[model samples]
Target: MLYKTKGIALSYIRYRESSIIVRVYTEAFGLQSYIVNGVRSAKNKTNRIALFQPLTLLDMVVYHRDDRDLHRLSEVKTPYPFQHIPFEVAKSSLALFVTELLSRTLKEEVGNPHLFRFLLTSIVYLEEATEQYENFHLAFLLQLASYLGFGPENAQEFEDQLRERSLPFLADDAMTDALNTFMSQPIGTPVRLTRAQRADLLDALVAYYRIHFDNLGDVKSLAVLREVLG
Candidate 1:
């Protein structure tokens, strides 16, 4: 069956000579893999390789079958082209890191319109962000956890527990408040945190996620993001 939906590119791998296997998280179908034929062919101008870039949003029409591992797409285009993420080094790295995290965090191969909307809005915001964004990924991760059904609703309690147990930076009141504020606020909301503080809170959140989700291993982008955003 053919279906029209909005999709956000998560990741893709080169397939054969001129083709690529791309995973797009769609509004109609959650995580769909499509083998885009000739997307990488330098001689072909019709098919776009940029459409498969990490966190690029697209409108797509796809062919689906029951319980199939791979799918086909009939049409795909970016309705809104990113203005900054493509050119800005920090934002580009952030997008790559976020999409990689999403690929691991979101496992279900079914429709999640709410989760999809949250991610779509987040990517747009990240692209347009002009203020402090060193902490943006941390905020995004916490909000995404809510969508994944294991949000840190009362991080203050956990902070106190960590302090009592003498768990590294959690013993610091400043770090504890930073984590609590990040857990409770929306993605765009600003919180006053230093570079070191932001890094600490993010490290804690990443540890928490690893404990909850078995598949979320070491995020390679963390080192680069910290070096750049620091």
Candidate 2:
């Protein structure tokens, strides 16, 4: 049966000569993989391939079956075309990191309305914010950890979790203050940190995530994001 759902495009890989298998996190059905044909072919002139870009917010009509692992998209269109992410290098880099993180962590095939709304609002927030977004990904990771059931409540708790897991955390004043701000404040809130401190906080967060997700290796986009943001 077909259903209309809002989805966030997570990632995709080439399937055949002209097809791709794309994973989308749908509001109605959770994470799903869809095989889309002909989007990569030269004869396909509709440019539909752009619809599968990372973190694209899409409104879709899809064919869903409870027993199927891979489903099909009947129709899809961007609900909110990004105004700045595609144009700004830092934002684009952050989007890639966010995409990679989500693709790894969001694996369940069950709908989570609260988590979905968190992700949707966060994405829109990143896209709309014009300044002080370099810390966006850091704040996002902390927020996402809460939704994932392992988040720290404050800077002290963050350090405690690291100690509890035997994970290394830099005990720097700047890093602690910045993390406290990130944990206590909402996304887009202004916070100050040096380049080195920001990098340290990111490493600490990734270490925290690794404690929970055993197989989450080094984030592939981390180097690029660091370079672009710095």
Candidate 3:
């Protein structure tokens, strides 16, 4: 059946001679995979493949099937085209990290409108933000955990939960303060932290996520994100 939805492009892999299979997180259907054909053909001039860029916000009409694991896209376009994420190094690196994180964590094949709205809002905010976005990914990770049902309310809870599982994590005063800020404040709020501090906090956050999700292996974009943010 055909459905209209807003989707966030997560990732894609080349399928055949001229097609690709893209994974998208949609507002109406949670997460889905669609096989798009002819996007890479030499005769194609419209560059339709650009719609699959990581974290791109798309408006789509799709053919969904309850019994099938893969589906098809009848139409797709970027309604809120990013203005800075693709052009700036720091923002682009953050986008990459966010995409990888979402692809790993979001696995449900059901509608999650609230989670989808949060993701959409965060993506647009990151794109338009020119400064004070260094903490964006950290904030994003913490908030996303809440939607996944494993979020801690504060630094103490974070440490306590890890300790309960025999996972050693010691958050110093600075890291504690940063965690509290990220957990309590909005994404646009600024929290001052040096490059090294931010990197350490990110490692801690990833460890926290690992406790809840067994397969969230090494974030491939972490090194690049750290270098770009530095």
Candidate 4:
């Protein structure tokens, strides 16, 4: 059967001399792999390979077979053109980290419209915002935790008292209020998070993901992401 859907490029692996296998998360199909033939060949190489870049949002028509492990793409185009995500270093790094995390964590063939929408919105927000890249990544991790069913229940888990007191950056009442709101509605970005708070939250999120996802081994890109954000 042939199907049309919007997909987010997750990761790709080189196959043979001129072929590649790309994993993508789609709105209609949760996770799917497509094999592109002659991607490195002289004919249409640039256009064919450009659609598979990390975190690229694509509208595609694919030929799916019930018994086949790999599918084929008949047509592809960018569904939402990014303004700054690919060009900006911080935003690009964040996108890469998030895509890697999702590519590993989401392991189902079933459709998830809500998760798809959340990711699309997040990518848009990351592209537009200038300040608060760390906050954005932290918020994304927290929000993802809820979807993955391991979000924290209290703010204390995401705080370091010694640093909090020493810096006097985040007010006690403000942190408390934000945590309360976050617990109530485990979606969307928090107002703001301090540098210490961001680190703590990232740790909490990674721990939460590990608790839920048995196969989420040591994330190789995590160190690179930390370096980018730090």
- Candidates by lDDT, descending order: 3, 2, 1, 4
Across residues 1-230, which tens digit of lDDT does each residue of candidate 3 receive?
Answer: 99999999999999999999999999999999999999999999999999999999999999999999999999999988778998898899999999999999999999999999999999999999988998999999999999889999889998898888887777788889988988888897878888888877787788889998899988999889888774
RMSD of 4: 4.9
Q: lDDT tens digits, residues 1-230, model 2?
A: 99999999998999989999999999999999999989999999998988888899999999999999999989999979888887888889999999999988998898899999999999999899888899999999998999889888888888988989888786677777788777778888888877877887888888888988998987999999878764
What is the C-alpha lDDT profile of model 4 across 17-83, one tens digit per residue?
A: 8889999998998899999888877776366787788888999999987677789998888967778
In model 3, the runs with Cα more than 4 Å from the true position are 165-168
TM-scores of all candidate predictions against the true structure? 0.92, 0.95, 0.96, 0.83
Candidate 1 lDDT by residue in tens digits, 152-204 = 66666555434554555453666656667767776777777888777777677
Clashing pairs in 1: none
lDDT of 2 at 156: 88
- Superposed by TM-score, candidate 1 places the C-alpha of residue 56 at a distance from the truth, in angstroms, of 0.4
Clashes counted in candidate 3 amount to 0
Show model 2 residue runs off by greater than 4 Å: none
Cα shift from native, residue 91, model 2 (Å):
0.6
Alpha-carbon lDDT, every model = 0.82, 0.89, 0.91, 0.74
